[model samples]
Target chain A: MHVTSSVRPPLITGGKTYADVTEDICRQVEGKPTKEWKIAFTISVIVLAYGTACLFWTWWEGLGVWGLNKTVGWAWDITNFVWWVGIGHAGTLISAILLLFRQKWRTSINRAAEAMTIFAVLCAASFILMHMGRPWLAYWALPLPNAFGSLWVNFNSPLVWDVFAISTYFSVSLVFWYIGLIPDLATIRDRAQNKVSRYIYGTLAMGWNGSAKTWARYEYISLILAGLSTPLVLSVHTIVSMDFATSVIPGWHTTIFPPYFVAGAIFSGFAMVQNLMLITRVVYRLEDYITLEHIESMNKVITLTGSIVGVAYLTEFFIAWYSGVEYESYAFINRATGPYWWAYWTMMTCNVISPQLFWSRSIRRSVTWTFFISVIVNIGMWFERFVIIVTSLHRDYLPSSWAMFSPTMYDIGDYIFSFGFFFTLFLLFSKYLPVINMAEVKSVIRSSSEKLPAKVAGVAKGERVANPTFNKDAE
Target chain B: MADLHGKYLVGVYDDDEVILHAISKIRKAGVKISEVYSPFAIHGMDEALGHSRTRIGIAAFMFGVTGCICALCLTIWTMGIDWPMIVGGKDPISIPNYIPVTFELTVLFTAFGMVGTFLVTNNLGPGVNPNMFDPRSTDNKFVMAIELGKNKLTEEQISQVLKDSGAEEVNIKQF
Candidate 1:
């Protein structure tokens, strides 16, 4: 397997030193914000301000502020919640799944993706609180004893399960992200020139000395954490899918929902990662680190998972017809030909058909094409959630009780508010932390142009120079 | 730097392979190495230094078991005993339904417990002053430090051993 070729593609394209890696990442934090960063940060802050205003209005005014009726109790709120939760999945999949599979390319992008997971989950949890109407009583979802005669949470309910799953997922992701940052934080700490910066980076670094003993344990802990996170990522999405599956709603009650949702979660998750990565690569001027090869590899994943999600769409219909359940059959038919047919076709075209273009190597390799398709795919996934929710709830078993669901100004505002929250946190994260993992990326640098270790001048003069070929093999 | 203790001899190298080679050579010569630091982890360096494997996985597994049992007991006590009100015409104590929460908590406890164990074992956390041998160790250099007071050999002998092991630069450090 040691095929030393002149054409071997380096993950880090530019010949870079460990010092360059540190400067590339730490300068973004230490230096003043660039003009592009200033513009993006301002937009995010404005969006957040407006969104917070809408949420305050919802709080002061009540549930009537939104366009929820008796028939469609969960129109946009739950849809946005599930969408944000789904977006969070790609981050963990990139970090934990790729690490487990020994995909070394993830070293360049995993830090940013994990940050995305944390922010996306935060946006998702906000919807749950807002949907509660009385947000102050949000803790009731927890399995806690109450003052009124020991009324505990209902264990059989999926909503209660959601509280545990989401809280656990959020906390675990936070710890995992923080632990991975320690070594890099130490790099920043060592490079700090000012007193305040030294104190901040030093505290975050947690006194890492980078000893051989410490490095060994750090690696062991990382592996165990990766193993732990694999199942947790799958479980988080599975439990979220259960929220719909356990219900009696015709479109919602399928055994296929778990796998189907997981696939779609990954599909959309990669799209968002691509979306953010494209902007980051350009804004941070990091084309050498996040090469077009990286983008193409991610597009390959988006295409693969996107196709799986498409197959899931068809499988749901086939099962609906094969089961001979009239309600299920009607639900499928209505989704295609009902008043919301536009949304249905949009989802199919974007998620099912559009990503098929990636099968072409030229399109997959093109940054512009990949970026355009990623955005379209994200739009399609959002519509998929909307169609599932609105199409199912809008129609009733009795025609007399049937009603159409439409979003009010408040609904639109709340959805926009989530974007504001997600972007705001993401922008801050990019500016404050190393956008790429410095320590992990340093381990992957194998450029032949790197300076070789020289032999000691006296007794070791004739000894063979150690070039790290075996080090590369062990890694 | 006021509380500086014993003098430390610091050896610097540019590559991990040289450090690994030097570690084995120096250890073979019977010089005690206090620690080796690098910008990135050099695989198998611990084994070269004869350090044993870490056991943090055991702590993780035990923490997971505790989470699973605690989750099950809570589900049973609340759904089957404390307030067993039937909803959706299902059984009060539903084992399958409780699986999600159980799994979630198990993962949660495992992750947090392992991280805490790592911090305590490594003596790492905010406000803990780090023992920095050289600032460039976090840059493009690898550093191996040997304490003069810890080893039976004199400082000059250890410095000679480091030079023979292919260290590019050897200097005396105080911290």
Candidate 2:
């Protein structure tokens, strides 16, 4: 709202104008590396190396290198897979889904979240690719002619749909991410001082000269793509849910999986965004552009989606008891009071119970509290998948096959390697990509010009907005 | 210059009220109009200029239909026609199975169709860039116009009409 030209606030106050925003965003390349970057780079590389080492050993050793008994076949690997994939949901959800809704707040965070989606999916895929004992023959999943059993892949199977879903999801998100990056890359190309930086950034700029026709069509195509991607994002997680729901694995079987899974994905993804943004906002000296208001807005989404996940949790317990089948009943009871009750309650406390604190304004507005909750929520979600995968399998139909699963050093290494995989991609993104959509963020700086002040005043009180929050209620 | 026969008196403005006032004034004065343009499109500007709702959306739908047919034909040619097999408990022509490819083709066709139609209708394509008025028109200004000869309006009358309607500046150009 502040429109002054030359009265720039310190980076900490974050009261930057358009030109200031441009300069601040470009600061990473314009300025040489500081001590802080060195520290961050050092830590990321160390952890990343550990992660890679863990991955190499697992690939060399085999599937049994980690831990997956017949009972708990999914265990930590699938849990990590689902969790990483879930973490990916928030990015596209924020970018595509929110764009369709025209949520202006998304502009500040979408590029980073989209990057997160790409990286997190890469991490999740690494786990999937590695988990394949015969990594070379993973093509058995594809619908190639003359493959095994003279057959096309079963469309009925969620796993088959997932191959399509994940691949489509990856390409769609990648294209969307790349297209969005074009203008920002041009901005960087124009701003770069060094010859090497200019050449690399200039090529990636794709010859964009901010042509009016291109911008108009760019806006149009972005809208259409967002519309297309919105359903794709939902379908992806829904199909992912079908992976579990299609089976009769007690806690995994439920109609609630799609929405619940989508919500949890957003919740964890927002947390990861919070984690990354908090660090970036601090380190990059971009407090004004990535303001507390932006963080608060994201925190609001986290709170709301987290509670949505909370309700899904309660509904699962309610439905399990209501079904009146002993296996289902015991499944619910087993998750709570079984041998892995600690894991179950940990999931509950982290995912369901902790997010409720957001109902209070004090906590949601506090960066320190939000960052802590974001981490806890992510942990809870990972454990949530773990609890679902393990508890159900540990006591499926007979006690004879029941076994407690533990991650060997191999399991730990693969997990670490996935982390390495995630951070390595993330570090590259942070260095190279726009990191935030400068054009979109610039458009957002002026706020919605058409909004009647009376309508916007209502937002201060924190009134709950309906899904697809637009003129439906306001008008 | 052969394409310049349909000369347009495109009036550009900033305020919505001025554009509305100008359009009404021109219509009352018995002047036929062409089109209104803006940086970010303004709602109700079409109605002011008496433009029809575009068939671009309809064209998109038709393109989508074409895409579905193409998808079906291709699937049939591949799965049913060329290399038919009966591995699962399903027919090759099942629409449920065709959805993924169908949806993609539909989008691809519709998008390409819209772009093609937009370019053709607007008289633009490869190696053709139209003359621009104010540089800022595409940034935050609004534009309105009529095909000059169709309305039988003189340049002076148009200028007066534009000034009365709150146009900051007015000009005539051939592309």
Candidate 3:
């Protein structure tokens, strides 16, 4: 409602009506796939198949199939885990955080972002499963009664906390996404051309009829869910950061890691969202719904959070020098000047230096530049996690144990496998589900319904005596 | 048609404002309204129709409190009473470390509980058939229905009331 003239660009560009909103969104679901979609889907499947084979090979031969040595035991595995987890943050931030703030623009993008969250979390969970050499025994991580001398899972460890956080995060996000989808699914259900499609949409819709009573309850539930997910978006990452913060490792023990990791997570998350939205907008030909203004607003968030992450980077360096602990100072120095200095410099440039370009209004608004920088920012964030995990562990207190960590073919293969998995799921989602939320987008339109002043005039002059301005029904 | 419940006169409106205006007009004439439908949520239509504010938030709060209590009890029972093991030189009954999982379960239960309450209250589930007043009610049109059996008004009076209230089309629907 607070409309700044310049910042308040019309979210839907083409003056779409309620019917147009439904048609544009439901078309992708009901219609045949384009040539572009076929090509992308094929490539994604191929990559996915190759990645799955690599993962099985690692599992078949043991963790040694990857180049992981004793010193860098968590090199690419945890880096991919954190990277995927960070990418998932953008979805909840958009759906839950922005919803509470009443940013109406989020309606256009939240659906796809929520789907991305589910897939990214799936990818993140896979890394944990793969890292456990005998994944069948991964149930030991849960707080279940084990046969090993009644040894219960440790309640004080961050790893155990992660199990609860990630699982709850997944189920809650899934429910929230499904609840939001109901009404839109009803719209699709009503418009389905065939019996099979109709039944499928009907089951998904769960008997939504758009009754006033149901809408009232639905709106209330949505607000409360958004309220619930806000703290969740923050807590999941804070627990993840605790994976390092609670440790005794020199580079990982800083108090700044919680908020710092959170900021970096959001920065990278938005970058990934931008990357996906750029491709989605093009492939789906949804420029009108996903306007340039949406891109610019997301860029503005990146500029702010990116700057916060940049400051956190500098703050870590200052604290390292200020504390003057030999091990801690050496850890920071080793990150910048040691064998893995390239990874550190990569993080600095991508996470800090590159995103600052958004300070220019022109670059932030340009689709190509935003896309390019988003990719770079994610790369930089991946290296940040890599630098923190590998460099710190590769060199410890004993100089005799000093070593360098490098990823093997299997390591590289597994990461690409995630991309394949992510895109394949995403492509399927885009084809089946309503990409844009029809109900929410309709709420944002200026016209609530069709203007029929001429029809209202047909009710006779006597009816107007009761309500004089009945003809001003343009809204 | 054999399983139809009753005869209801349905009035269609192009705009939400018109429907709001029509509801008051029809109800003021001593006609009982059965239901109203719209494509999207109108801002104050529920209040105008005299429905009470939903108590879902209260349910969410109570569920959240339950989650908090359960989480604390689970952590205590598992770590302190069941089997105590020192971790990272910290106490087995450390409450600070218990906060993360506790907070997570609190949110998780609250969210699931609230959604469950909503679904049950609405009589909705996977295979249940919905009552549809009109297909276009989920699209662009708004509809208000007055069941003849619920009100003592004659067919002529109800039709007249709908027209006087500026209904675009009035139809006799059996569902």
When 2 and 3 are scored with DockQ, the better candidate is: 3
- Candidate 1: chain B TM-score against the reference chain B: 0.92
Interface Cα RMSD in Å, per prediction: 3.1, 8.8, 3.3
Interface C-alpha RMSD, model 1: 3.1
- Residue-by-residue lDDT tens digits, candidate 2, B1-175: 1343556666766543355556767788877765554433333455555655565556767887997798667655656656665535667556576566555555556556655664465544333433444334433445665666666667678768887766766766554
True contacts kept of each: 0.81, 0.01, 0.74
| Candidate 3 chain A worst ten-residue window by lDDT | A457-466
Clashing pairs for predicted structure model 3, backbone only? none
Q: What DockQ, between 0 and 1, does each candidate earn?
A: 0.62, 0.10, 0.60
Single out the weakest 10-residue window by summed lDDT for candidate 2 chain B. Answer: B126-135
Candidate that beats the other on lDDT, 1 or 2, i.e. the better one: 1
CA RMSD for every model? 3.8, 8.0, 4.0
- All candidates: TM-score: 0.94, 0.75, 0.94
How many clashes in each structure? 0, 7, 0
Model 1 over residues A133-181: C-alpha lDDT tens digits? 9998877777677783257888888888889988998998899899889
1 or 3, greater by DockQ? 1
C-alpha lDDT score of every prediction, in listed order: 0.85, 0.70, 0.85
